[model samples]
Target: MPVSPTYRPEPRFFDLGGEYGDPVRAADFPETRLRFRNDRAAATVGLETLTDAEWIAHFGRFVPLPGQPGPVAMRYHGHQFRHYNPDLGDGRGFLAGQLRDDEGRLLDLGTKGSGTTPWSRTADGRLTLKGGVREVLAAEMLEAQGVPTSRAFSLIETGEALQRGDEPSPTRSAVLVRLSHSHIRFGTFQRAAYFGRPDMVEALVEHSRSLYHPDLAEGDVPGFMRAVVEASARLTARWVAAGFVHGVLNTDNLNVTGESFDYGPWRFLPYYEPGFTAAYFDQTGLYAFARQPEAVFWALTQLGGALKLIADAEALTEALNGFGPAYIRELRAAFLSRLGVKSLGEAADQRLLDTTLALLREGGEAMRWEPLFHDWFGGFASSARALSGPRATLYQSKVFADFRFSLFDHEPDRPERLEAAPFARPEPEEMVIDEVETIWAAIDGGDDWTPFHEKIARLRAMGAARNPTESP
Candidate 1:
């Protein structure tokens, strides 16, 4: 394999000992077909130099990278849909390797549907091809929306048929490799505490703090908890601003790095409906679009509870209490960023956000979420442009009057962005369920990848237009 000079492999998780994970082998599939490869993410870890065959040999064949450890199925217990499940762990995937990016930040190369582990229970640990495609789209869209999320590094179709109750039986299978900051989840600490292993809890805390939150002092459990709370709050706020519904908010899915991953039944909102849910199984709407903040806070509390084994109860409670205020603060910031406007102080920003939400709620089904922000991206600066746009009639309605007035009070952050090619289009790049199904249909029916690839290109172009300084 041709390795880049900047390649820096660091098998840090392997140092946590056998109790934290189990060494595992990937499944031998009948076929290895590459579906997607994120060269941008690869460049971060110095793996962009590899040829396609070499990339498959490493990622698909599960050949250990130079100076990297083999796949290790991580151990943890999590609360699934508010129910504590001790059997939960890396049932289908493993932490394949770790490496430092160009910025010296540690990143984990984790797999999904690679093979079964000891925690596989009674099911086959393989992912449906549709599931893999959906995840790639979800990750890309979230990233483009400026949400902190895991990048879909590589996706390879494996020649196998798997039965799934959620979809039609005998679905195609694939393996996904996700690039994320850390694989250490809130459940990691919970597992340690559940076992009455205070030492392990302390070790986990130190490991997380040192690797992910290096700003904290040694063994600063309270500070570490506070950092995680703030990061989680920011993540939730971004999701809200992006109108993303992460169907599952389990403790195992929420990681220490606060990057959103493990997309099962995620969806982007068509409008501002609070009760909208992505998963059909979510009959109770526990993880609804509007309830995401509460869900994340609950997950954080579970993490805090696990940390209570080693830290003081008062300190943990104090950290937990910061969630509400932090969420509000980050929400304001996130909304302002998405609206492409400068803040007019906290009070004014709050009013603008309140008015914006009210307008959306009142607009009901008639108003699409992304277009509102897209059309008025530069706030009052783009008024002339928006007024003559397709949704101009709705914008001129009485219900939108307050939001319009409030928006005018703020200055545009990057007014030049309105002149970009993406904004010139009638509609913004959206990943609605209908469009997602359409893209999937192209591949499922005739194996035509043109739509899928074209959608990705358009998405990347939109991302680049929105964030001109960023590398796609």
Candidate 2:
């Protein structure tokens, strides 16, 4: 496979020191295979480029350094499915090293699918090739859609047999290395809270302030909490805007940096249903699309509980109170953008949005999420009504309910142009879980990546055009 000629990764903030601790051995596998890594991801975390050796050095196996401290095993605990688990941390995984990108940002070079750590709890620490592939695809798409996330760097099939619940059989294992701003999660704090380690929680909060929320470092602890709360509110709002349902929003999965990471069983909505759930095991729909704001607020409450160690109790309460207002403002902004409306200050426009949502729910039109948004966009603004297929009638019927959206006034030409617009377009062929396996097969075979790469670049460009202020 031909590699890109030049690449550079942006620096992350986790570069403190190369602390050696417990080095976990990687499990052996028979299907060992090397594939071209995501060069864009390598270039994102300040890596100038990767030669085969550099890639292998970081991912293939764990090598202990002489005179370096042994791997410092981290201890953490968090709520899983709302149940508190006080024992969870790098059980099956370990941090390999911390690297400084050219931009001087510190990025964690961690290995997943490496052998189990003390936290492994009788389970294999290794990840499957399929899991790694889905993660990469998810990271790329989410990032392009303006969501903060971890990027998959390289995925090497380790060739070892491993058993898993989600797959057909014990399969050859794979190793995944990803780049991110921080791997420290809300569960990290939860762990401390679980153990009644107020000092540790405070330390972690201060560490996060220096890393991702430095502006709040000097503020009173309560004020600092408000800053973090607001950041999280906006982040959740963005997730909702993109039609993303993070199936596992466990406390451990929530990052302190407010970046979305740890993808598993995640799915984009086929249509706009506030109650949509992506995880089969989400029996209660606790993390449904419509409940995200409340879920985030609940997570913030947990964060506040942990931060109380460092902040005054009254101050923490005050900070937690700010979550509602911040979330509401961000949610409104996100919905407005989804409609392609420059502004949504008018009473008429608000009524239009409410009525559209009410009508969709009443009609059970959750699968028609995008068209519903389009209906309002074209109806309220007198834009094109180029909807085709059976969906056109759905749009026409609901949109024409108000005299404001008269049939003659609707621009028939607008639908034609809207048909060409790929925004919110969900291709049916790419929706299946199995199609992901095909994508990996193509990548593994060193077949044409031009089409895939081009599509990624196009998405990146589109995201840039829509939200110029978002980080790439």
Candidate 3:
């Protein structure tokens, strides 16, 4: 059952000054417009249960509720683009509140470009509809790929004018409220360290331990550091396997919850290229697809530096060192899943994937990322002499020929029994982004919805396919 737009949500509040500084109401902006409402995501984060009246009660305005304290800018410094910046925080954003899900996870509900706070500096502190839309698209696609991400809840077009680096003019305005596990970042600790505020640093660590590391009863600060290290290792491994380039994996962007946040200059590679990068400014390829693991390690070191203030230096170093084996294990799991192969010995798995990547790299300009994976999962049919035409050319290359023999004892005709097996599972109807786009397009054109309704029903039937459960 899909969540709908009309569900009512419960209300909760948090003092925003701890991190988020302040907020400006959308109604005050001239170009404000209501652009999109992501009801599906709202439902997932437990906000979709909000009734119409309740929605009005909570977010209709930016006023503080009874006992709700005033917001303040969270003070923190960070390393941006590998250079240390001793000042960075919720410059253009503020936390509206916080909510606990049915699973008892505390999530920060915050807004971007909501308005100016003490940290706003010289900027207008506003967001454009374009930025909001891109975030929606990116978050939805990433969620489907099993990445832990900050979920976008409401995007309201402020109809006010705004300027940005990506757009031509200060034409449209918008505000994006997001739900995230926690906004405490690596920079939070960096700020305390820079100020020589060990007490504040310790206090922040304790707060974080209470929030994200509730199970840290074993080794105090050392255990908490280890948990964060392991979570980051696993998170980064998934980022690499998903072909995601975060572009700017700065210390400020590294959330304590180990979820990916701050979607900027991110791109999913069309094919596997270690040098591929999303941020145009990253000419040095510091945060390229292949370098993410190392970048994560560097960030973890910064984390270790902060933990050192609270715990023993040697213990923190030992915990941070766990990233290597943890990363390899995760990478192997992801690779095996993509290859549609049952458990393979570590050596065999590495050889198989490494050989395949080598084959793709040899293709250079002609390579397509998914096809290599798709083709190999299709039984490397050319090796069996069962593939024909364009696909046969894939095998003709001298680069791939050497590995073909390694995959098969002797190239035989397609395995008769396996050849007829079904390929991918039929996609879900309501869940397909393409179908949803068509429906929205029709609505935008102001067309009669009766015909569209019938079309959707037929398409839904075509999209449904039942099969035995299997992991891939």
Best by TM-score: 1
Task: Encode model 3's per-residue lDDT on 1-472: one tens digit a residue.
Answer: 2223432232332322333233344335554344455555565555566554445444434554333443344566788887998757777777666656556677776678777766767978777665665565556545544567887676666667676676667656677877788788888888888877777667777777777788887338888888888888878877776667888999988977888877777877765688988788899999999999999899989978976776899999999999898888877656554444444467766665666677777876465554454455424543343244335566677667665644543222223313322223121222232544455455345633443445433332321211122121
Error of 1 at 451 (Å): 1.1
For candidate 1, report its TM-score. Answer: 0.99
Candidate lDDT scores, in order, read: 0.92, 0.62, 0.63
Q: Rank the candidates by TM-score, best first.
A: 1, 2, 3
Better of 1 and 2 by TM-score: 1
The TM-scores of all predictions, comma-separated, are 0.99, 0.78, 0.77
* Model 2, position 87: C-alpha lDDT score: 71
lDDT of 3 at 398: 69
The best-first sequence of candidates by lDDT reads 1, 3, 2
lDDT of 2 by residue, 123-233 (tens): 877787667767766777677655667777677778777788877667556888776666777777777776777766666666667656776745356766777788788
Candidate 1 off by > 4 Å:
none
lDDT at 287, model 1: 97
Candidate 1 residue lDDT tens string, 1-472: 5789999999899878999999999999888999999999899899999899888988888999999879999999999999999998899999999999999999999999998999899879899999999999999998888899999999999989999998887889999999999989999999999999999999998898999999999989999999999999999999999999999999999999889999699999999999999999999999999999999999999999999998999999999999999999999999998899999999999988998898889888888999899888888988887889998888876768989888888999878877778888888888899999999889999999899988888888778777887665
